[model samples]
Target chain A: MSEEKRTDLESLGEFGTIDLLTKNFLITRESTAFGIGDDAAVLERNEEQYTLVSTDMLVEGVHFNLMYVPFKHLGYKSVAVNVSDIAAMNGTPEQITVSIAVSNRFPLEALEELYDGIRLACQHYKVDLVGGDTTSSRSGLVISVTAIGVVDKSKVVYRSGAGTNDLLVVSGDLGAAYVGLQVLEREKSVFQANPDIQPDLDGKDYIIQRQLKPEARMDVIAYLKELEVVPTSMIDVSDGLASEILHLCKSSKKGAMVYNAKLPIDSLTSTTALDFNLDPVTCVLNGGEDYELLFTVSQNDFDKIKGNPHMTIIGYMTDASDGIYLVDKNESLIPLSAQGWDHFQQ
Target chain B: MSEEKRTDLESLGEFGTIDLLTKNFLITRESTAFGIGDDAAVLERNEEQYTLVSTDMLVEGVHFNLMYVPFKHLGYKSVAVNVSDIAAMNGTPEQITVSIAVSNRFPLEALEELYDGIRLACQHYKVDLVGGDTTSSRSGLVISVTAIGVVDKSKVVYRSGAGTNDLLVVSGDLGAAYVGLQVLEREKSVFQANPDIQPDLDGKDYIIQRQLKPEARMDVIAYLKELEVVPTSMIDVSDGLASEILHLCKSSKKGAMVYNAKLPIDSLTSTTALDFNLDPVTCVLNGGEDYELLFTVSQNDFDKIKGNPHMTIIGYMTDASDGIYLVDKNESLIPLSAQGWDHFQQ
Candidate 1:
């Protein structure tokens, strides 16, 4: 290899490589309203309706560990993660196409277990498995899913549409999935040391389930519809609250101040985080794989959701000059930093 | 993770996993006309147009050898292969979505080089970049791209639509890409053995180019449009001609008789195959990644394409009882086997 041509990926990081890969991409079709910058791409077919499409690829060894992970939950979470993208756009997922590449190392029964979870998730989410491609892989299993959905042109929400005064609300609690992973890893290590030991997973069940079989939050979409709520901007917190909130802030051209007191931490997640020697608040900010929707609501609809059992008003949008900040219980304003899924850190 | 729940991916192979994963997958919406069983999945929207969507994932080490393959060609080929799937359905090139997961091993500039080729392909095919996800991988780079294109409801063809008495035709030539790959691999081996020897690629440019940068036959879509001809069935020859023909047969409930002499072979591919002591016909039959279009036309339209220079009428579709046969140069009938890119065999 040429000395100058020896390129390393770490130097680019995640966003840097992404920017490099897509810089020259041109939107040629008139139907493509938006492309790479948003959570989900927007395509318009007519004046009345628009189509939303997004895709995600999960590589074995990179995304999961088969040793401790169930194929069934893997299947469910696979669909849920992609579906969460659609839910973030305030769109109902109509169809999904799954493509899988596997080596001969998997068994028919094992695959049956995987698909059973897929079928179960399909039944749960009301998504159709319309089409997919099946091919052999040289290494571990890879699942790539593309979801297609539609919404009225006027109702489709994007990450860039948030206004300055919009309230930032997150459905469900944060840090649960992160805490769940801590428990799973702790048990796994203990079990590894002593094969005869049984896992002591009592109160951490919710967090464990959050990490294992999280739902797409389509219920939130339906609930929002019934409540006549349309988020000014929306995003799913797959990569933690801080990173997601930053996305909303960057795209919406606004800043936010989320109160630490207002942050929802499930009892189980908080206790588990404490057990792991981690700060629960920091876990909420930096923890990922929550699959919860974080969205902005106008002040006009505040009263309608203020009493809701499923929603929590974590903060409100602020002027760009104020910057993204978090007011802790000490009444100190601290700048929010996104430490979500830094896959490129040395 | 339980001791009782040990499952390996290789036990299922590729097809078994697919069947297991999509066994219960259903099409709930009217727009999804076909699902899971064909080359490209089909979707219908609005009145006169149907959208064809297909996705492919390429993982480093598994899909390509970065040692020999340039990153730029990898990006270009990624888009080309996905676009070929839309063309497989006799659809026009339109919009595509790309998702990539990279490790920390790459630099920002490297991604730019990759995207530069992607943008070139987009400009070449006139397909818009829609939306996709960019994330981190623990290992090699993984790229998953989904291309969506529109086809007139009447003109859109499926592999299952062919019938007895239809004529089978292919655009451009076969096996050139595969031969080109052979040449590149041979050169790489030599280069690895000793870097002092430069690549002996002189007079071997055409097949090498074909393998490195194969173009999807969008021109055939235009040609059929101009000729006012609609193919009864169509598919891209990505998995070699034999496998594609088998797919057409299995889907369309028919058999075929492909004349060996009529198979198109570029002069360069034939000579290169000879140099490698390989049968040119076999390379053309079982070689893959050509990205050429193969379709079955109605008997009535045969005369319309009788004098067309771009397309060659290689064979005719027949009853399933007739069996899939290859008429050798000696005029003897021989059963055709699909030795196309067997990941298991690889």
Candidate 2:
């Protein structure tokens, strides 16, 4: 490192860093149908089925602050996020491996509480807790969860499958998790200033729940199966709408045209964003950790999804020659920029 | 945690912690051929094969030290150790997901060096690097690797398959990795006190390599296939020979009797143990991180493995009432104790 050119991780960004490090890791196994560039890696289990695999790691202080985050909530969020990754692939998760590295400072009871949340998530998802590794860390806590799922080979979707003219749809409202985080941060600062002052998060239950216990949209996946509609391409909104949409565009070699006013935002999210003196539109575009499913379907299937409470068509795919852009409220076109959560920033 | 029963993690130990936490995780999936209590979790992929899954977490300070250990070796060892788990199950690893949580203090160049080793190991094993998550940490680096493998249902081995009178066999020699660690630790201290002084590790290359980069016993697995010998029960020798033998005994509900005379000990390992004023027998019994395969084979398959350069028959399984014991050089019986690596100690 001393003699080589040193590059700061923050400047490279999280996805950029992953791309740089794994560029040479060519997939040689025939079973590996897809690797690296999607919500989940797909492997052909047999001629008829494909196994979907995805892993996510949550680090204390970087992902969540224990001072405001309960261990139970943290555990549930960790599993839910990984489950969302599987859901992004339009697959049903059947098993997961949860590995945790905790500091000695954490008592056994603390871990039990965390496991309680994990157990609840596993039960809710109906996925077996198959295997895991537990070891002590020198500092803080680290939880890494890998989810395994299956999908029919004919029904499998990929990020590179979207075509021009496909209608873009989202499963849930955006920006609530980011706004909930703002509320928590503000309340923490207020408590620090005056320990006796109680938190005033009385009627903000929706946003709080959205942030603390976000659910993977397995219900939407089930609904899609019931409707007999398969998305050409899909991704989860873990890194906000803007970033995820751009990823889909990059992988599919297409462009997207998103109508800013058509974005689904919770009323509370908009109100909270205004209260924090931030633009609500910006929050909806860039707010992360929503865990919502974003997908593109053929125009022929648009009527089937029309008027569905769970579905919202916000945009349409465009030819690669057209740049990814957003039509703002003022009817002005602006190019989209990805401002996803970058954990490497100091 | 304060008012309730605050049990310490050390009292629970690593294995105990995993058992207690996952005890309520009911495996409702029909695909789960086996869950927990083995080198890897097994899933029935089809009538012909079972999918083997295992995960391991490596944390800096607890599992390794960057002061002396190179990141490249650490990367290779991490993947190699996880692959050993699959090998212990008599499976061929096909894919792996590696998640690393690193602090922002790390340079992009350092991560590149680590990935270089990871890429090398993947190439050597011919396994696809499917997918993983990378995130920033507040402290030292944490790596979690999950390996997926496949074994024919007829050839699959588990830690619970051994029966009374089965012979215990181990691949390769023991105590070398522990002695090598001692050498590196001594060199580190010497370098700390006098940075200008060169390290005196010229002839200790064999043992040092064993400590820094232990290979998984996949070769032994291939050899066993060639000999058409399926072990009754098997496990990887990561937590010392004594501990691994006890694990197989417990899982199989049998007792084992190992003779000190039959244990394979390298000449360099014995010479280094004496240099450190440690008992060579004790080191062979209690030193961990060998990454060798320990298995129990039926008496009928003895001829297939006998005289094999990679394997040594060290012991035999016995009735549960016989109790696990070690036969000393003096011909005295002593109870076996498992002093495996427990990372929860303060």
Best by DockQ: 2
What is each predicted model's overall lDDT from 0 to 1?
A: 0.83, 0.91
Deviation of model 2 at A113, angstroms? 0.7
Clashes of 1: 21
Over the stretch A77-143, how does candidate 2's per-residue lDDT look in tens digits?
8899999999999999999999999987889989998998998999899898999999998899999
What's the interface RMS deviation of candidate 1?
3.2
Best by lDDT: 2
- What is model 1's DockQ versus the real complex? 0.53
Cα miss at A241, model 1 (Å)? 0.8
Candidate 1's residue-wise lDDT over B15-59, tens digit each? 555665676667777767887876677776677877777888777
**Model 2 chain A: which ten-residue window has the lowest total lDDT?**
A1-10
Regions of model 2 farther than 4 Å from truth = none
Give the interface RMSD values of the models in order: 3.2, 1.1
**What would the TM-scores of all predictions be?**
0.95, 0.99
